[model samples]
Target: MQVIDLLHTATRELAEAGVDGGDLDGQLLLGACLNKSRTELFLAADMEVPEEARRVFLRYLERRKRREPIAYILGEREFWSLPFIVNPSVLIPRPETEFLVEQVLAACRPRRGLHDGWILDLCCGSGAIAVVLALELQRDIVAVDISCDALAVAQQNCRRHKVDDRVALVKADLLTAFAAERRFSLLVSNPPYVSRRQLRQGLDPEVAGYEPLLALDGGEDGLDIIARIKEMLPVIMRPGGEVFIEIGAEQGPALLRMFAPSAGAAELVKTVEILKDYAGRDRVLHLLLSGYGR
Candidate 1:
């Protein structure tokens, strides 16, 4: 069949299945099968698709129709302008996480002193944050995730970006694997913050059905992992270190209170500010420890 015909069929099927951006997904899936760019696919609209390629396109279409994310289907997703391998084992890196990376860079780039300390990436998943930071900061990073499968994918991504040597992938439950003496200058995380009620209420099939639950469930209030990280901050963070954590929009107030100085949640925490995403919603919690730059 012609490329255009297959694209139309895929688009219709995906749209009927309630997939958003069906046309774009169709283009991407067909392009992957043909190993062509979307532009090239359009240019070759009249060209005939090979039988094997056509079959693969149909199979990809079937997966999309079932609400599988295009990133998982394509076996890759672009984060911070670099392609990273992804699968059911890891959460697909979202654009909001880029904000987390941005805040981290902004905090550390201007200060040379912050460069000397250790960097930790909690719940590193596909290692997107670690790989990007390794490349951007040219520093060593220890990335931790609980799932070996997720760690394996993170490893592949690290190697793919040629940052494997700098980004150490560790399979551990949060900071449990770290020693008390292991203080870090900068710690960043995109941990599981989805509440149990949110899960029960439901997420898109692409998330609830395909993404790893280990990376999504944040406990009853969705602050379970964040709370744990908060508890460890006073112990693990350097005197002047900074932390950037991606969080739900509604979570800023709770986190503010959790990390507030008066709350004594984490005594050394000097400031707790929530950074907004593109939508101006609370997205990241930026914390500066006491004695910053000292």
Candidate 2:
């Protein structure tokens, strides 16, 4: 059938199946099967697709119809404008997470003697943050995560970005395996902040059914892990060191209260600012420490 006919049919099918971006997904899948860019796909709209190519495109359409994420189908996702391989093993890096990286870079630029020190990326996922930070600053990084599969994907990303030498992967529950004496100049994390209620209430099928729950379920209140990390600040950060943490949009105020002098680690914190994403939602926390860790 003609390329346009095929796209038109698939788009309708996917849309009926309740997939968001169905038409765009159809275009992308059609372009992939035909080995053409979107522009080429449009130009070739009236051309006939070979039989075998159409079959492959049909399979991709079926996957999307089932709500499989496009990133997993494409086997990669772009973050910080660098492509990183992805799978069911890790959370697909989202645009909002980039705010965390930006804040880190912003905080790093003004701080003297910030270069060359070790950095930490907790709950590292696809190592998106770790890879970008290492490449952006040339600092050695120690990235920790609990899943072996996630670590494998992260390793591929580190190599893909040629930051493997500067990035170290560790299997750990938070910073549990880390030596108590080791301290870092910077720490960053995009931990699982989705409460069980949020998941039970419902999520996009692409996320609810396909994405790793280990990376999404943040506990009953979603603050379990975030709070644990807060208490451990003194163990990992050096005096004047900073941290960038990505949180659920509504969790920022509670996080600020948690880190305030009356309730949390006020003695160690020098400043705390919750930065907003493009949507104006609280997305990242930029915090600096006032003293060296034990």
Alpha-carbon lDDT, every model: 0.90, 0.88
lDDT tens per residue, model 1, 210-287: 999989999999999999998787677888788899999899999988887677745477777999998989999988
- Runs of candidate 1 exceeding 4 Å displacement: 292-294
Candidate 2 worst ten-residue window by lDDT:
109-118
Q: Write down the lDDT that model 2 would get.
A: 0.88
Where does candidate 1 have its weakest 10-residue lDDT segment? 261-270
Clashing pairs in 2: none
The sequence of per-residue lDDT tens digits that candidate 2 reaches over residues 1-78 is: 999999898889998999877888998888878889889999998999999999998899899999999899988888
Backbone clash tally for model 2? Answer: 0
